[model samples]
Target: MPALDDLSLLIEAARRSGEIATSFTGKTAQRWDKPDDAGPVTEADLAVNAMLHQTLTAARPDYGWLSEESDDGTRRLGQRDLFIVDPIDGTRSFIEGSDTWSHSLAIARDGRITAAVVFLPMLDRLYAAAAGAGATLNGQSISVSDIATLPEATVLATKPVMEMQHWTKGDPGFKRAHRPSLAYRLGLVGQGRFDGMVTLRKSWEWDIAAGALIVTEAGGQCTDRTGQPLRFNNPDPRLNGVVAGGDAVHAALLSGLAQTQATP
Candidate 1:
């Protein structure tokens, strides 16, 4: 792994990219859709992507790049350092003029993310973490909530009304709160504002890598639907079933998800 100075450079680059994004918050801009129709991608996404790629590459020319807006190439797999980025994580929120969107940045070394930075420019919140250095939000340390039981915990989840029907069918005791972006939802958990977060559907690696590290460094746990730790730079880019929360709350949430999956 490289020194923390290198990681800090990545964080600085992300903050600069956030500033570029914030400058166009309400400006009239063109928007377009990706080929898959997965979601909308705006000009802002591309503009920030270009800015991040340029800045990061300039800082560390040897590091490989993996970004949402850039074409996928296996060249990054051969490099010791790689930058995993999502130019605009919550493009929907950004387009809708919502403040929940953010810019996510992470550096992976040998397939594990060693440093992370998520910047919510609208809210002026910056979440950052380096391996073994702990996580911080806007220069202040943050940790997850201490709720141990499902009935007592507040969950930040996505697509709950549509995709999480199984949970509601068997467990009426749990409560779910909706958040537009995975990055924002995970940030809420890292800040102790929410007790837990779960997602049943698949998501991109860039969407959760930085936030997952933040949650874990803040004394929380994050894993896939089957309660497995997350891995980056895999051949398959999709992530399935994210479960994250404080220690006891994470356990209870995973147990509930297990029961839901086992039923029928």
Candidate 2:
């Protein structure tokens, strides 16, 4: 199918996922820990995941599947196309009654994301993109900020990423902000709400896949913290890290990251 056709599917799937997720919000749906300390997962997450999995895979049974709430296996590795999803990208925030959480969905073909959507139902924000088609939010085109320099950039990052030792010379001094959802941070960058975003910790493919495509299609650049281009559906299904921004800002973040001793 054409990437845009796939994008249409993703957009609809994301909306349904959002509805399933939000139904459990403000009221307790069961929550618990994963065996590997991978963070929390609630009943809402599973419900959304199940709906997305059944609806999407049934529509494209030839494609593979990888989801945060599902068991991981090598089956996805054999397919040329597959779904990479995080039914609820910010379970903790959802559990805490925060509205910033999102449902992230993407279709990866031959290791590249071709169609993607990140939806925050509570906020009514929907960011969507198809490879080579640019990006949009709520049906309006969006682009990255024009800021070119690091000092003038307003970046989204966790507090630990701002520590002095993470920079080669010293603090780069860009204003730092944060969001509980990695997908949301990337969406904000794509929407031009922030100049950039950084996460030096190893990131999950399901978490970053959709957002990465949205940022790039919006005229921003996205890569691993080491400045490598991102490739999805790997055997491990995890990335070294993520750094995304407008052209100049992305370069600056990579240069600073290279000087640090950190490894993701």
Expressed as tens digits, the lDDT of each residue in 39-125 for candidate 2 is 998999989989999999999999999999999999889999999999999899999999999999999999999999999999999
Residue 40's C-alpha lDDT in candidate 1? 84
Model 2 residue pairs with clashes? none
* lDDT values, one for every candidate: 0.81, 0.92
Candidate 2 regions off by >4 Å? 259-264
- For candidate 1, write residues 1-264 as lDDT tens digits: 464776688678877887777777543657887886768888889989998899888988998888889999778778888888999988888888888788898988777778888888888888988888888998899999988788898887654523445443466355779878788788889999999988877778898888898899899999987787898887766676688999998887776663334211
Stretches of candidate 1 off by over 4 Å are: 1-3, 25-27, 159-165, 258-264
By TM-score, how accurate is candidate 1?
Answer: 0.92
> What is the TM-score of each predicted model, taking all chains together?
0.92, 0.97
Q: Candidate 1's error at 57, in angstroms?
A: 1.8
